[model samples]
Target: MKLDKYTVGKRYGKALFELAIEKHEADSIYQDLLKLREIFHEVPDLGDILSDVRLEPYEKDEIMKQLVSGFEGTIENFLYVVYNYSRMNDLLLMIDEYERRYDEHKSLLLGTALTAVPLTKEQHQLMEEKAAKLLGYEQANLINLIDPDIVGGVIIEANYKVIDGSIHKQLERIQELLLK
Candidate 1:
């Protein structure tokens, strides 16, 4: 039987997260995972090389060894496990799963603030506070996303909900009212 990418990610990522928590290395693992994700994104072909069937396991191990040279054992072991199972291509999915778990562990809501322009530091802080309050979370991590078409105001996308306060949405609502 074969597992889908999402399942594979959930299994491996959850295992790793649990291990990190048990070892009291969650923070370290989190930082390393972020760096590892950056590396994979910047050099996508690295995953292909690791997952290539033609390469002997030893060869692949050597490459992974180099990649995890300075990283902690948890990361290296996790990479090897992923490679051995031929799930190299789903590394990003695994990272995302791990991040989701991390956020939950920290009681955080990760959200986006979409606006016509970039948010100032003060505005970003305020949005995070407001998002936390509106979403009923103690903490929120908001990333500012600029969408010029919004035409001002802001749209908050968080926790599978969209708070559309943008001028574009307001205008559309008015148009619908007029038509009615």
Candidate 2:
């Protein structure tokens, strides 16, 4: 059977993650990956350019080197491996899987909190603590999303479950009850 995207990403990510751990640069490598991810987000077409077939391998390599000039050793090698294998399109997935594996190893949970307005640092800390307690994790990596459409309150997503405490959802529930 053909392997899936997730499987391929996980394999590459695991190999890179192990290398990072062995080199005692796990945190640094993760930070580099975060920066790389930011670049991908800022320039959506960068991925397309890297994966373009018309571009020579040396040209693609040069671009990738410039993009990750600050990174060294294992990270550089990992990029070359992905490029040589023509897996540039899976770069984001690899980063995501690498983060997932790293977090798993560190006993951390990733969560998202959506609110009508931005949360203060104190609010973020409190939410992280609450999420950790509820999710039974040592700590949580919380990503805050400001969504005015939520109206008020917060929506917490953790471990594939959604705790919809938003006023918009509450109002919808109440309206459904009234109609019934």
Query: What TM-score, over all chains together, does every model reach?
Result: 0.86, 0.72
Show the lowest summed lDDT stretch of 10 residues, model 1. Answer: 70-79
TM-score of 1: 0.86
* Number of the top TM-score candidate: 1
CA lDDT of every candidate? 0.89, 0.87
Tens-digit lDDT track for model 1 on 1-180?
988889988988899899999999888999998998999988988888888999898998898888888775888888878888788888888888889999888879998999999999999999999989888888999899999999999999987899999999999999999999
What is the C-alpha local distance difference test score of candidate 1? Answer: 0.89
For model 1, the stretches where C-alpha displacement exceeds 4 angstroms are none
Task: Write down the RMSD of all candidates, one decimal each.
Answer: 2.1, 3.5
- TM-score, cand. 2: 0.72
lDDT of 2 by residue, 65-112 (tens): 897687777887888788777777788889998998889778798979
Name the candidate that leads on lDDT.
1
